[model samples]
Target: METPPKTDIAAALNRVLLTRKERLRSKNHWAGLAKIPTTTVLDAFKGSNSTIDTLTKLAEGAGMTLAELLAHGDPDWEVQVKIRNTFRSWTIEDVDGLIRLLERRSGPRDSDAS
Candidate 1:
């Protein structure tokens, strides 16, 4: 199959940074969290494209995958990405327990909610 269309990396990085500004705060903070160089973060803020490895670290620092970072324009998708990131290191049983607890708090799921 043909590869999916490439996102505009610079634009995507800008969007990610904007969406995460409250947490990331400054280029130095972002670089520290992503374990990348401050200059790289500055370049990204200026709309420069970054290497995949750099992008991956940046995405991780933002609590998301690279794909989620690139496709992060939607508000709902943003929530889902955050939830998925939060759950990434949990055991299946732990996740199931959380789901059950959430279900109890929220009441039964709607038939069409899924």
Candidate 2:
């Protein structure tokens, strides 16, 4: 799948779960995933203080589609994934949503860690 543009990442997620509460309650949710919530992940983006491997693990655990998390939850689910390509140092293939998130967060342009 071709990777969607980066901008739509967050928007797709908004359309998806509506709130952190719902994402938490998802069928795929697991204790490993819940250990860190979306808000926590979002906040970590602010300072590049988070780890990518951790995020990917969470994403997989939560059953979040990869394309959804990678584009920051962009509208397009298609992924032209240059699998294992790290952006802004956010690449951790083994992990779940963690790598892509960290990549965006570490960058100066996407430091919206709120």
Candidate 3:
């Protein structure tokens, strides 16, 4: 399939931010969270030929990984990207802990723990 237009990508990002439900509503707010300048975010959204680095920062500000943001309209792709990014950042200890937690949850429930 052909890649969607930049406008569509921008709209998707706005939609993601809107889903935040009153936490963020402005470019400046997102920029502050992403540690990037407001103009950079605005330019990227406006399709002004921003660098990947700029776009990555914008995505981070919106509580998404770069891959998730780039996945745009594809919900499945976005979810997969989020999962991949999460695993990418996991340390061995974290993975081991998660495995233990999952195993315990799947095992017989402890009345006191519940």
Task: Specify the highest-lDDT model's number.
Answer: 1
Where model 1 places Cα greater than 4 Å from the true spot, the runs are 1-5, 73-114
Residue 107 miss distance in model 1 (angstroms): 29
Candidate lDDT (C-alpha), each: 0.77, 0.48, 0.72
Per residue, candidate 1 scores C-alpha lDDT tens digits across 43-96 of: 876767678888888889877778788776444556756766787779999979
For candidate 2, write residues 12-50 as lDDT tens digits. 334333434455554234333647665655544343444
Ranking by lDDT: 1, 3, 2
Candidate ranking (TM-score, best to worst) = 1, 3, 2
Q: Write the per-residue lDDT of candidate 3 for residues 1-114, one digit (tens) a residue.
A: 997544356655666676653666777888898898888878767767767788787777777777667666454656755677788899999999999999988998678974
**What is candidate 1's local distance difference test score?**
0.77
Q: Between which residue pairs do clashes occur in model 3?
A: none
Worst 10 residues of 2 by lDDT: 76-85
For each candidate, give its TM-score against the true structure. 0.55, 0.33, 0.53
